[model samples]
Target: MILPIVAYGNPILRKVGHDIDENYPNLDKLIEDMWETMYASNGVGLAAPQVGRDIRLFVMDSAQIFSNMDEKDKEEENYPDAPGIKQVFINAHIIEEHGDDWAYNEGCLSIPKIREDIYRAEEVTLEYLDQNFKKHTRTFNGVTARIILHEYDHIDGKLFIDYLSPLKRKLLKRKLDDISKGNIKVDYKMSFSK
Candidate 1:
């Protein structure tokens, strides 16, 4: 099912998500549904807060992207992690933000079709946990940088649209409201709901 992406103006997007714990229920299924919702909505990444969960978790899938590069090419390009299947990040922690900022065409699943050029760090280095709860850190570039940045925003109580200019933000306000209301396609109730 396509889980409803909490829209831009929603208060949940502005509320920092709380850290997850051991006693929390449905750890496995929550990860599964996040992957399903991400694919169904044609998103490469998603955060729990984006789905109203208020938990420090996000899911990412980078399939259908560059995956067959040779070792030499990967070394030269510096993008080695071609995402496999759907990976989950729980209790993520950003230890550093590095490199200069560059502008790219960015959009949000919550905002649907609206797209804009947003500046983000050219590269990022951070630590996050895999589905198995193992810790890993690596540099991300290009589109991966964009995806991770967007998901990080969910954890920090912010949205992509918040970075827009006043006039541009005003222009999107009504559309955002419409998307938040009921005009856009979303499925909040899942194969199971809490």
Candidate 2:
């Protein structure tokens, strides 16, 4: 099912998600629904908070991003070889972040239609579990790391907009307010706090 993504200003988005174990109700079904919702919404990543669930879970299919990029664009963007990475992350924690921070244009499903250049570390080492509750500690870099970092923030009760400077955030106040009140036009279904 395609769940209605929670919009900005929703209190759930501000809450740090709790870790869930394998026995969590309908874990497989929820992950399936999340994938459907994310692909339907044309999002590279989706966190549980975005769908109104305060759980440490997220899905990413950055392969879609690579499919849309041509060779020149890929070369220019210095995008690494992202070969159709489709994975689920549960109870994730970033163990460490390496390399210098780089600016990347980031966006979120909760904060629809708002994209900003956010700075993040070039690489991240994460410890997380897969759908089956199998644990793995992995390191990611380049565009993949950027996407993971963005979604990781969601589970931590942080938004990309929060990284903006005071002046930049102030300038986007009206637009953010509009999003909270369902004043923006998004192709996907969204639930607002109003």
Candidate 3:
């Protein structure tokens, strides 16, 4: 099942997600649905908040980014290794972020047709639980880390647009309002503000 992604002005997107344990109802099903919804919408990452669930959970598949990059592009971007990561993160926390900030054009399923250049640390160390409730600490970099950071923001009640400058945000205000009102067409299912 592909759940309807919550639109930009939805209050749920601003709510901090709560941590959930293994016993959470329909855990596997929810993750599966998120994956389906994300892929259907051409997204590399999807957080619980995007699907109207205020839980600290997200899924990411950075393989597409890895596969799309040519050898020359990887070398030029200093992306020597592509982790090709595909995993679930539950109750995730960023332990540290280091290295120079790099700018990446970021977008969200919840805020379709909006992409902005966001600068983020090149690497991030995170602590999270996997699908089976197994705990792990991992470090990620390059495109993989970028995707994680984007989704991680969702659980923290932050959006990529929040990182933009006041002027930039103001410029996008009308488009954002249109999204909230369902004035734009999107290929995937979306729940808009009434």
Candidate 2 lDDT score relative to the true structure: 0.92
Task: Sort by lDDT, best first.
Answer: 3, 2, 1
lDDT of each: 0.74, 0.92, 0.93
Error of 3 at 125 (Å): 0.7
Worst 10 residues of 2 by lDDT: 75-84
Question: Across residues 1-194, which tens digit of lDDT does each residue of candidate 1 receive?
Answer: 45766775577778888877655698788888788888787678999987878888998765534565456865675443555335677777777777888777887777777899988886677687777778899666666766787888888887888888999989888887777665665444322121
In TM-score terms, candidate 3 sits at 0.96
Highest lDDT against the true fold, candidate: 3
List pairs with backbone clashes in candidate 3.
Answer: none
Q: Looking at model 1, report the run of 10 residues with the lowest lDDT sum.
A: 185-194
Tens-digit lDDT track for model 3 on 43-71?
99999999989999999999978787788
For candidate 2, what is the total of clashing residue pairs?
0
Across 81-170, the per-residue lDDT of candidate 2 in tens digits comes to 466588899999999999999998998999988899999998999999998889999999888888999999999999999999999999
User: What ranking emerges by TM-score with the best candidate at the front?
Assistant: 2, 3, 1
C-alpha RMSD values across all candidates: 4.6, 1.1, 1.1
TM-score per model over all chains: 0.80, 0.97, 0.96
lDDT of 1: 0.74
